[model samples]
Target: MPKHVWITRGLAAIAVGGLLAATACKPGDGTSGAGGELDGVTLTVAAKWTGTEQKNFEEVLDGFEKDTGATVNYEATGEDTGAYLGPKIEAGEPPDIAALPQPGLVREYAEQGALKPLQGEAATALESNYTGYWRDLGSVDGEAYGVLLKAAHKSIIWYRPSAFDAAGVTPPETWDELVDTTSRTLSNAGITPFAMCGASGWTLTDWFENAYLSHAGPENYDKLADHEIPWTDDTVVQTLTTLSEVWGEDDMMKGGQKGAVQTAFPTCVSEVYGQEEAAMVFEGDFVGSSAAEAGATVGEDAVAFPFPAVGDKAPVVVGGDIAVAMTERKGVQELMAYLASPQAQSTWAGLGGYLSANSGVQPDAYADEFTQDLSATIVEAGENVRYDLSDQVPSRFGATEGRGMWSILQDLLRGSTDPEGAAKALEKAASEA
Candidate 1:
């Protein structure tokens, strides 16, 4: 997962009356010149971003500071933001704003009364920039509290075009076709059919989610995500059985199941692109960057297709960050509103590793044609998009190490458990979580 960060300096304090007058100004109501209404206000923001992502976000913060004259203090605390913020929140000194990646955590904070509802420019900017599905993701009980900042499309299958061409195979269009293609690649080309990153359980969960979403349809996908339907439901069993068609095969995966369980995500990409040991890998658009880092020519040596349809329609699963305000200060709201704007999103998108759900941003904002096409595919999905199911559930059942979906699915791939048994284990975990 990627992180996002922004920082600025604080302004001199203004009188209460002056603050009230400043709050009345809407976004774009005044020229972005010197001596803006928020000239003297300062805010603190925390996120799990560092390195280039932090640098890219700093460009957006610079724009905000120039536009509003407010300063912000930024912190890159890595992925354990809950650990970093928990004590401060308990001590009554939380940051003015925080960029949270998990919608489940956003809902947790909002339900616990630790998050402030978006108002004024922030509220208006989100309404104008994002779609209803995005807006709903940031809301709790019909009240908006967070704004989606960055996004990743998780419904792509990446492969080396040369490998496919050598094997006389084209991108499959349906589940049966995908199976046939895999079999043909193995029998005809003498190469592994799939690069299954079983070591990273989250990747395994994505496989199941993509299959289940198409198998059960959007409504049931939501129900399963919310635990409205038991894991033992027939849809789950069918999904697992469908997945086993490939996972359970003797030589369908690289190094068989054992090799997949030992291979990490980066190595999985390397196997397909660097070593030419595998024919295909299923992952999000972010894999393009990873492939480049591993010395593969993305979009040339490597190309991607939408995950093949298992039912009537293909499904799109997304993962991203949401910016939430912890205080209602004028400067905080102004910063949140700016972050949701096309200008700020475009600045980040130009950095080559960022994507935004904000529909207002133009296609030319991206760094390459492939990214632009990928973003267009996501935008076209619109209301049909679904979030990563494991990320939507409780941390104990979804994110915990050694006990969550990661370990359970690894067991299934290792042939220690069957689909029915795995489904029962998932139900028990969800119930306990």
Candidate 2:
């Protein structure tokens, strides 16, 4: 979902050219001075970021270049990064680095020797900046292979302040209270309370993930993600039924379930901020940008709050891109180290539309009050943060369209299956995966 932005290519990047420079030094070595350690290095880094996100990342790259004198080429792989990276890697010509989209892919590539093991300074940087929760997401078989360069806190609900004021209802802190608020907003203000992104399968998964994490607790969430328990387990059935409490309500979704199934992801954000506005849309923090596109000013015209507590604690479902080294080339380890440090992530953190897993990054480094609070929320959560379950699971069971979590949840939204039926279908898909 972090990559699901309105991306567009802007200025051209340095082409994959020039010679591979020799390793002059590691991070903090004297060679980073003028005529720098990586003076002649040309490192190629590939990812799915473009548009403003791309522009912000280039600023991070510019800093790396200035510090190390490395000439880095930027490669945008669009949505289908594997299609672009797969052939290049198979031909024994992988880029120096790539920002893998999923934790599962990081493990697969690490197991297959497609990814190089990050050692020494890079590993140390990762451990120092991030908690075990973050470090483990980038490691395989007890070895670190990736660094989470960008992060997203997904358990956020964006709403119109005017809608809440009109209804005289404050944001709720508990699930039952949220359910009550939704009804009150509709009854008191004649507002449609929720904008559903049923058409974007991943958003539905996020909904389920938040419920599962809070209701079943983090340990069970981890087990379910690893398939240690079947999808048909009671916890999953209970979570699905909980989701239906809202989905089953005729007036809960802005256009009802059918229309929700027809709505794309961004439309869900805009529908809450545009004329004839709905009261709310529940998604990741990325919705802030989509709200802006709808002519809504973030933290003013629109505001976000933590997803209400479903059980004893609030759930934080994190989504992010992990930087992985594909080869042990000169300047690669140094770049990896920099990315794992607060210095690199903070560069983009102030530029907006980004959060860093690096705890060393101070909350004040963010652009505004909303971002500062959001960044602080993530850092304070420490090892309590969990990565996206769908991203951690096998793609066949997690991401495939017309099957897996996407199809099952979409079917659930359409009232095509009951909670138990949805659980069974998901179990069948996971077994196949």
Candidate 3:
């Protein structure tokens, strides 16, 4: 059986907390420590994957190594990384290449001269193949530093088809309607309308950013990128207000407020598809697989839809993927070139469940309808594609100061802080950072 998943609020907090811990370390240029001769032969790669993830990466790297006659060394720490690769890098033993989920962190390293600029064919491939928002994730100050490898769809709401059918509940089309539906589910059906795992700082942060995008418009996130906007903006206040009301309702979320605090991450996912009575969950597309891995029949039993529109704006999604680069070995350049190629992208999608970043590169292996539809949604997103705000924000500010926004929400839920007070608290954090 698959691992019992806990998508708890605590896990989310720990994940972000791990990244935040990396902020205080002294920087390194990934130079080989101990004055060892720099070999242009082996590429020590550190990725955020282990077990099946490690196996999949090894397959791709093995192909690259075999085709190019290069030595490839791979290590995966998975999600248990505390300070990530920061201390190892600081000790002068940094992996020649590392694939990280946070592009904002990658950009910080690049700014400190830790990352080499990816140019020529690699840059061109990224520009032409990936969506513009994805390209922006790995970019800092107008220069492209990282390659786009995977695209995770975030604007998804996973629900049980059986439950909706039985309860005669329809997926709402607008934010107001969604809120109204939540109330209906509680008052009429006695089911928890929304399942919020707020104890996890990161997951709660998702609510903050998602609601922020709709209430404030996606461009406000871009403004935060440039330090043009404060965390205390009125838009943020509105989002917190909305979440506070919805999440505050008794029996609004399964397990109640206390359960929201204690439940794990995977549990939040399970609340949606674990049973027909659990109802819907607002999370990323990956939640679908989590439900399936937890024993729910995917596609038929569970279905996903975009977060309903909050106002006049179209639905906006948040997500990006990990990008990998091996050492600068002979023909490693060629392999890197190929890694960014459409063929590589197609193959990678076949090996893993993530959406391919290479434009027009659809895989032959059949994926779930939701996955396929999500892929099409990425392609058809036009110019409205926005990445996860917390992922894109600088670690010092984003990881540290920005993540505290979750606690502010909790305070709002408990009626300890009003919208205006919460906004000011966020502004103080942002300004201090």
Q: Pick the candidate with the highest lDDT.
A: 2
Tens digit of lDDT per residue, candidate 1, span 178-205?
A: 8977456654688778888888888988
**How do the residues 154-217 of candidate 3 rate in per-residue lDDT, one tens digit apiece?**
7767776666666667766667777776447644765666666565556666766766777777
Q: By lDDT, highest first, what's the ranking?
A: 2, 1, 3
- For lDDT, candidate 1 versus 3, the one ahead is 1
Tell me the RMSD of model 3 versus the true structure: 9.7
Worst 10-residue lDDT window for candidate 1 reads: 2-11
* Candidate 2 structure, TM-score to reference: 0.91
Cα-lDDT of candidate 2 = 0.81
Clashing residue pairs found in predicted model 3:
6-265, 6-266, 7-264, 7-265, 7-266, 8-264, 8-265, 9-200
Q: Is candidate 1 or candidate 2 better by lDDT?
A: 2
TM-score of each: 0.91, 0.91, 0.83
Which tens-of-lDDT digit does each residue in 1-433 have in candidate 2? 1211111111011101110111223453222333577898899999999999999999988888998788889999898677788898889999999999899989988887899988777877776677678888889989899988888889888888777777877777778888876555665668888888899999999999999999999999999998999999999999999999888775787788888888889988888987635888999889999899889888787787788788888888889899999998988888888777767777788889998767677655678767766666666565456899999998878877777899999999989999999999999999998
lDDT of each: 0.79, 0.81, 0.61
